[model samples]
Target: MKLDKYTVGKRYGKALFELAIEKHEADSIYQDLLKLREIFHEVPDLGDILSDVRLEPYEKDEIMKQLVSGFEGTIENFLYVVYNYSRMNDLLLMIDEYERRYDEHKSLLLGTALTAVPLTKEQHQLMEEKAAKLLGYEQANLINLIDPDIVGGVIIEANYKVIDGSIHKQLERIQELLLK
Candidate 1:
């Protein structure tokens, strides 16, 4: 059976998360993982270099060591293992999975709100409150996604569901019905 990247990542992430929690370093480890994600985003080819089979294992280890030198203990050791297995390509997925699992454990809900333009602070807060209530989460962390293509309205995604209030979606639905 072939496991997808997410499945593989989730397994590793869950293990790391559990270890961090046991060690009382969950928050610190999660922060380090978030930093790693930011680094990955800033250096798009870092993943490629880590995952590139053409590179010798030693070279990959050196790269991993340099990148993760600041992190100690669990996170550093975890990165070393990931590099040893040539799974650096899965690092981002693993970080995301780790964050999601951590949030679930903490009773926090992370969501995204996509709109044609940036939302005002008041609008954002109101949306977050509504999303929290709708999802039955004590609090909601909604990140704003400015998408001009949405054409107006907002699309809220949380708890594995998408609530599309975008005019673009509305128009598409209308067009589909008319065509039918």
Candidate 2:
């Protein structure tokens, strides 16, 4: 099928996801996307090079080929599609959205957990289990963040939903109530 811009991105992402799953390389693909995101940010001219209409399609393809030479197979194809469609500007967003969809399809929730201190491995595991149970997901990928400003307690964010259990937030709510 001829895919639209969004569908093209979804297709690219789905293809990569399937390949990664089959090869047990999902983590590698995720890391590759992270690296690509960083490279795109660091090299300001790269985007222009990809999107430059002056360059013939073959020339652009060559440039992309060199850029992704060291990437995993799945990511290599992802870059090829991005370059072929001249969607360099949307590359990172497309990959991120695709990953999000892939995670959702696997019954996994990607989220962040903020705490006053770093969590122990046991605590992390417990939190992951609790989050999965509460969110009704089979798995949870919880990114941990340490924020002393939180004073104590934890805050969790999943799928744009925030569960605030932080002392800082509680204090703010109390202060507001007192003022009222």
The number of clashing residue pairs in model 1 is: 0
lDDT of 2 by residue, 77-155 (tens): 7787777777776676667765786688778988999999999999998898898889899989899999999998889
Candidate 1: deviation at residue 47, Å?
A: 2.5
C-alpha lDDT of residue 62 in model 2? 85
How close is every model to the real structure, measured as TM-score? 0.77, 0.67
The prediction achieving the highest TM-score against the true structure is 1
lDDT of 1 by residue, 6-86 (tens): 888998998998998899998999999989999999998898899899988788778887898788888888988888777
Q: List the residue pairs that clash in candidate 2.
A: none
